[model samples]
Target chain A: MIITNIETVPGRTIVEHYGIVQGSTVRAKHVGVDCVAGCQNTFGGELKGYSQLLEESRNEAMDRMIKQAQQLGANAIVNVRFGTSMITQGASEILAYGTAVRLE
Target chain B: MADFLFFVVFVTAVFFIGQHIQKKHFASLEAREQALLYLPAVVGRKVFNDDDVERAWLVHGTVVVSGDYFKMMLAGLIKFFGGRISAYESLLDRSRREALLRMKEAAASEGAHMVVNVRFETSKIDGGNPSQQTTGMFEMLTYGTAIRLKAQ
Candidate 1:
């Protein structure tokens, strides 16, 4: 399904609305990754491992949302948004939500 | 005594190194922004007419940045005093600008002329360590719809 974080997908008109669809996942850093991140904190720079981990989680959440949208027969998702929360010491919950719509 | 001595030395070293790195990063961000000024990234939901648009797609950029020890320590002190933590402000500012720059770069690489409905998501990724206050790591993600207009 096509996805855009806007009210309407460019070059397309929405014909049907599937309401709101959402997907979420919780991810924890591996011990090795945590060790690497600790080093990053001490030395001060981009935390590559954490960035990768969050990016993967976000993609997974988006995929799940897309699957739901597809089940609703929607061809596109609009006004998508992302939310994040720290669930525990090392785990975070990533949520992706959007309005699924059919475009013509 | 030795522990305190090492802590002092580490903070001093990080202070200088962090300043240098931040200066370099700011310089680079300025140059890259100048290079990408042709592309307009706006937060409006409006899109160009279909006749004038060739294609549109989603694009995003994510960055995870951590503050140096010196800044973290400074933030901690400011926190205790309940005042504005300027040290951390720069950290957030840099990451946000960097994230937006990356999104713009992505759009440019796709030959897009404009980006719309830009959104930002900021999260602290401190490994959830209870002492995360001092870790001062944040992840900034910027996403938008990139529109490539038809050539006139």
Candidate 2:
């Protein structure tokens, strides 16, 4: 399915709306990565592992949202937005949401 | 005594190296900003200056950056007093500009004349340490539709 954050897709016309759909995932760093990240906090630089963790979290959330849209028979999703929260000291929650619609 | 000395050395080394790297990154960003000045204007709204669109497609760019030790230290102090945190401001500024530049470059590479309906998203990834007040990484993401206006 076509996915975009813009209100309208460039070439597609919306035929039906499936309302709002959302997916979210919570992730926490493992002990080893947490140790590495602790070093990064002191040393001050890009934490590649944490970055990757967030990326994975976001992608999983997005995929789940897409799956929901597919189940709803949506051909496209628009106005997609992402939200994040620090669920706990060691955990982060990533949420992806959008309007599912049928495109012509 | 030996362990204390090693700790001092490690902090000093990281501080100096991080400074060097930041300086280099700032210089490079400045140069690239100048270079990207002529790229298409990217805005958040959907109104296109030229309506004769022959072709258009979505484009996106992302950048990940983190603060140095000095910056984090400054941020920590600012958090206590609670004023404008210029250290984090520069970090955000750099990330935003870098992401936009990457988007512009992507449009240019695709031979598009302009980009519209631009949107930006930011995410912070902090190390899972409760005691650490500073974020470990920040990501700036920008996306828009590149348009090719028909020749007049």
Candidate 3:
């Protein structure tokens, strides 16, 4: 499925808009990465563990959003947007939202 | 006396290591920013120029950075004084810029000439509240659509 944050996809036309479809997921890190991330804090560098976690969370959210688009009979999602919020002490929520559309 | 000695050692370590890391990060950002001078990325919600009419794809760059204990402690002390938490400023700056650079790199790899509608999302991963530990993590996600211009 084609997903672009732009209002319209390049080289394609939008025939119908299926309102807004969205997906969100909440995730918390494991203890091993938590300790490693803690140790990483001492040196003040990139926390690869947490970065990967966020990336995974983003992709999962996107996947669920795509499924919603599919259910709406849309082939693509346009004007996609991503959001992230700290849900709790150790957990975060990542959201993917967009306008599903049938392409011409 | 023992606790005092440990604080002294910890403060010294934070000073050396934290400052060193911060300096290195800025230096890298300086170089990378210069290298990415050609990519036409902007934060505007709408694309200003539409003449190219080429391919566009979604791209994202993510970065996570941790704060040193010294900065955390310094922020704590500043909180008591009701002043700005300047110690953590560099941490935010570093993560945000790094995330943007990564997004640029992703776009560049796709042979994209520019990125548009760029937006940044940030969140705290391992701090805040009484249940969590002392790990101070900030995550920045930069995402946009990379635009590849058609060859003339």
Q: What is the C-alpha RMSD of each candidate to the true structure, in Å?
A: 2.1, 3.7, 2.0
Ranking by TM-score: 3, 1, 2
Candidate 1 structure quality by residue, lDDT tens digits, A1-104? 77888777666789999999999999988899878877767656678888888889988999999999999999999888888888776678989999999999
Q: Which residue pairs show collisions in model 1?
A: A89-B128
**Deviation in angstroms for A18 in model 3?**
1.2
> DockQ (C-alpha) of model 1?
0.60
Which model scores highest in lDDT? 3
Task: For model 2, state the Cα shift of residue B133 in Å.
Answer: 8.0
Query: DockQ, per-model, please?
Result: 0.60, 0.32, 0.66
Per-residue lDDT tens digits of candidate 2, residues B1-152?
A: 99999867876887787767657768888998787776665576466543466666666666656776666766778899899998778667876877788788888887887777788888665542325445566667777767776788
Candidate 1: residue B66 Cα off by (Å)? 2.0
What is the per-residue lDDT of model 3 for residues A36-68, given as tens digits with 9 covering 90 to 100? 887777767788998998989999999999999
Best by DockQ: 3
**Which numbered prediction scores highest in TM-score against the true structure?**
3
**Comparing 1 and 3 on lDDT, the stronger one:** 3
lDDT of 2 at B49: 47
Residues B74-117, candidate 1: write the lDDT tens digits.
87688888978988788789889999999999899989999988
**Interface RMSD of candidate number 2:** 3.7
